[model samples]
Target: MKFNATLLAQFFHFILLLIFLRIVAYKPVANMLKSRQEFITNNVAAAEEDRKQAEALRQQYLADMQKAREEAQAIIQQATKAGEVQAQEIIEAAKTEANRVKDNALQEIAREKEKAVAELRDQVASLSVLVAGKIINQTITPEIQHGLVQDFIKEAGDLPC
Candidate 1:
């Protein structure tokens, strides 16, 4: 074969093949590649949106848990305060009852003291009348008996009961 002629023919043939492939397959293959790129971009954007929504939901759940914990603490504090108030009320009631009982006991003691004093006066009066009758051997007038009893009480006034 002649070298120059063969090289020239091969070059012409390579140029024609490039032109035919550009017309037949280049545009379709480039369009397919662009469509695939768009599909990948759309999928990435959707995944990013989903991630953001998941983060928002997680934040909302954390906020709800914090609010619930605060409410529970408030309820516990209220219960503790109520219990303290109840205990204070019970203590006050017990103190009031104790005071009432003490007053009643004091009044009973005073009444008993008065009854004993009255009975002792009666006995002293009877003894004074009997002694007067024995000393004079006569019945004493009521006025004289009264005077003797009064004098005896006066003399005994300085003595302890």
Candidate 2:
């Protein structure tokens, strides 16, 4: 091996360059990479926490919807029951009114029938009295009047005097 000053100086210069690059560029680049890795890890963890919170909120919304639906169904059922009750009440009231009207009509018919019968009886009595007076004036004898009266009575059947 031949010792050359120029070769040694070149070698030494290359070592100094490597040391300077390590101190100035390599360390700074390595620190920057480490910091970037930490930032990425923290961001990933925060994103995972936010995803969990969103999932919880979604579940809560679904539960609230279910409760609202149940309440609406209950209200509908109550309204249906109330409507049925009202309908039944209306039907009962109508039936009662109809029965009352029918009873009133029957009573009115009975009163009319009785009034007609009384009027017919009054006319019959008047006609019978007029006939009796005529017979009394024409016969003028007690025996004939008595016999005619008996015959009239027999022919008239059960009519009142």
TM-score of each: 0.64, 0.69
* Model 2: ten consecutive residues of lowest lDDT: 152-161
Cα shift from native, residue 74, model 2 (Å): 1.4
Tens digits of per-residue lDDT for model 1, 30-90: 8999999999999999999999999999999999999999999999999999999999999
Write model 2 residue lDDT over 32-102, tens digit each, in one string. Answer: 99999999999999999999999999999999999999999999999999999999999999999999999
Itemize residue pairs with steric clashes in candidate 1. Answer: none
lDDT of 1: 0.86
Roughly what TM-score does model 1 have, to 2 decimal places?
A: 0.64
